[model samples]
Target chain A: MKATNLSTPKFCSALQILGLALMVFWFAAPVLQAAETLKLSARLVWGTNRDKSADDELKAMTPKLKSKFVNIFKWKEYYEISKKTFQFPKHEGKQIRMSKNCEIIMKLLDKDTLQVQVIGEDQLQRTVKHPLKPILTDGDLFVVGGDDKDSYGDAWFLVITHPNLGKEHKKEE
Target chain B: MNEKLVIQIQAYLDGELSAEARLQLLARLEKDSEARELCDSLKAEQSLLKDVGEKDHELPVAHSYFWKAISDEILPHPSPRNQTRHKQTAGAFQRWSAWLVPGGVIACIALVVFQKGLLDDVLDGIKSTGKKAARRAPSFHEIDSQQQNAGFISFRSESEGVSVVWISNY
Candidate 1:
């Protein structure tokens, strides 16, 4: 027996619906672009470099740090402690809170550079224009006690900015 | 005569009437000239039908062959050229469909692969993460918390656009 003509309209209607959906998606794609971001990790270590002269305070914190190193301080070495990870805005500028009464204002200078301004606990501020290199740049800031002596320790910073870090971090979780 | 009486006459001629009905019908035929005429006409009609039906006439075949006969009668002539053309069209359609089914499927898969930008995304992810993983182990910055204080101004990943800054005595 010859087949009747029945499926033509249904097939055409399906095509029309798909075409309409494509048109809608094409028009709305740009407005749905995802927000871009960056991840930053700051590690503060209070320890005498094995090569440097041992300070009294660093010598005291060394044994305690080594005892709690693996659990509390995953990174090795004496007097090396504390780590903070934060996300920064990719498109504009914002002051990221680091600790009590201390915040760093960061401005995205471009795709590869950042204008970083650090405000210390004493209300003193310093700014550094740094590139997003994988290597470390030291002496970004120095924290001195109330006594203010040559015994004051200097801090070094290593900053890495990668586009996939946030995504990789999220994938790990 | 009325339709009911005519029907009764037909039934009687067919020998379908009961004995009581036959008696009542015979009485009606005796008293009514119209009823008698109808009965005679019906009887003559039935006899003529029987004579005509029995005289060397062919009996009709059952209706089981009716649709087949109608189909043969109305169908177009089976021209060899037309048959070959139909077969060729069907064969071409089958061959094309054999290729087109898988071809269409492969085309759809290719479109989906490209549409989602899967290859580029994967390559870019590997490239960026690979760069990071290939880099050297990070050097540790040691500060004496008791002798000197440490403060974070800001830390940011330029590519990722994230940062953290904090001040710590230790």
Candidate 2:
């Protein structure tokens, strides 16, 4: 056989292979899925382009939950002082409630460097200090955060950590 | 009176003078009219600090009875200093550090966010942002009875500089 004999796959053979591939894809799907323990679900949106308006771009990214990050900060120097203190607005955002043994963690993309993990016990008791970078983990989901390494850079992420179970209170005798 | 001598009289008024120093100062005070005036001025400052304390002793109470009752019940039993410290790690400044436990966390996280470059500026910025609940699932494998299974998943950040692993439990 000449080297040129292997050109395009034969149409009948390709059709047979395509059918097999689809079957394989479907079969491998769930087993592959079981391997995933965490899901970071969110969207990014952008407003108009240089030529387009910011409003127009955001509208295009509609409903996806993602957006172009607008960083307008530029100054001669970083915060001139150390020990600067700032307060964040408390979030009364949706309280993601779940059954016992299920924790919900929400990381804020703009507010913090450390992920905040709050355990969701029955009454929110019990302090377990494992020192695992304050990550929130459930049997099914995980949420974590890290800080920007650039010196005095303004990137931040807020990670919310919650335990699956609440601390049990000691009953009074 | 000389300024130095006036200062000496001020120290004497505060009871910071020794016996010989007091005797010497007293002699000068008796001889100099200006020394006597300086002593009167020093006495006024001492009297002022004392009066300030008396005034502070009468501040209005801040807590109402009802609020106190709620606080007593809600706040956990903070054991005595000795017993409380017996449980936590020990150091001379441990007590003071306790006050910082909550506030320290707030700062560490806030600083990291600022450091991570999560904030990219316009034009030369990441066009999109948001976590992709990466929907890739695994293929199922036939297992023998009572056999354990294991698998791994990998992920990368937008910069692609950092990667993480999600390991399955079984």
Candidate 3:
């Protein structure tokens, strides 16, 4: 007996539908994921050689987070001056005040790209644009910091990250 | 009797000879008794064979079954060339069908990786443009400092997977 013919209309229709579905998924996956507003955590951290901050309201940084800062900078201890978690739509910017002296304006330039403007003492200090997907997906840190004007020897950091990035990374593992 | 003459007589009886040849052979047969006798025997044998062939013979199985068996044997045994052509067609179909899904998947993955800038990072790492470039693993599209007193330095630590942008106060 002859084998079944695949050139028939039924078979061709099925293949066409399958191809259309895959193409839709290819384009739609990123759009669907990017459609939701981005949730981010911005922290104002004080990095100093002193073991503790003079202000009692400041909280000590998490051990896992402190280890990351310790490995990169010369700071002996890290204290969180303020931390804010917020969500903003794509291609738009949001202003978050982490502390009285430090605030940051974050803009989602694209799905995985972000532009950050750091304002310290009501002055625009720096503007940086970086890809946020790799950092967030990989559970990495994006830190913007400089020497403190009030305290000459100490430095301050504006640490931005995805709040759920670590949990997602752990799930992946 | 000569074998050649017997063959000629058979041809003459079968009407296979041309008109001239037929007349010549007929004249020889009239004169030759041996040729006449051989021709008669050959004609009688042909008639008997024809009768036997025309006689109805019953098959052990039904007629349809008998014919079907022969068709089954002959139909399944296709010519070697046709079989090769069929195999080639099937092989091509299988190859295309097999690769369709995987090829689509690979294309999707490549697109996603490219869109995510992972491919660029990999390429940059491979090129290792400079000392600073090699260390700058963070995929930054742009960076600017608004104040003259403040400047920014950015680098990535591959070991910790961390990107640091240090805003230095000069």
Best by lDDT: 3
1 or 2, greater by DockQ: 1
Interface RMSD, Å, model 2? 29.0
Q: Taking the tens digit of each residue's C-alpha lDDT, what string does model 2 give over A2-115?
A: 123332324435445655655665566555544323223211111222333355321222111111122221221111111111222223222233323323333242222222
- lDDT, each prediction: 0.50, 0.36, 0.77
lDDT of 1 by residue, A21-113 (tens): 556655554343224565565433443333445553432232422343323322344442334566755675776665555566666665445
- Docking quality of model 1: it rates as incorrect
What residue runs in model 3 are displaced by over 4 Å at the alpha carbon? A1-9, A12-37, A51-55, A110-112, A165-173, B1-136, B139-142
Model 1: how far is B86 from its true place, Å?
A: 20
| lDDT at residue B111 of model 2 (Cα atoms) | 44
Off by over 4 Å in 1: A1-9, A36-40, A45-47, A50-82, A88-90, A99-102, A106-153, A158-173, B1-121, B124-170
What i-RMS does each candidate reach, in Å? 13.1, 29.0, 5.1
Worst 10 residues of 3 chain A by lDDT: A1-10
lDDT of 2 by residue, B1-170 (tens): 46789678778877899999999989988999977987887788888888777333666666676676776687667569855675454443445454555455555455444444344322223442422322212112111112234343444333221222322321
Q: What is the DockQ of each candidate?
A: 0.03, 0.00, 0.28
Which residue pairs clash in candidate 3? none
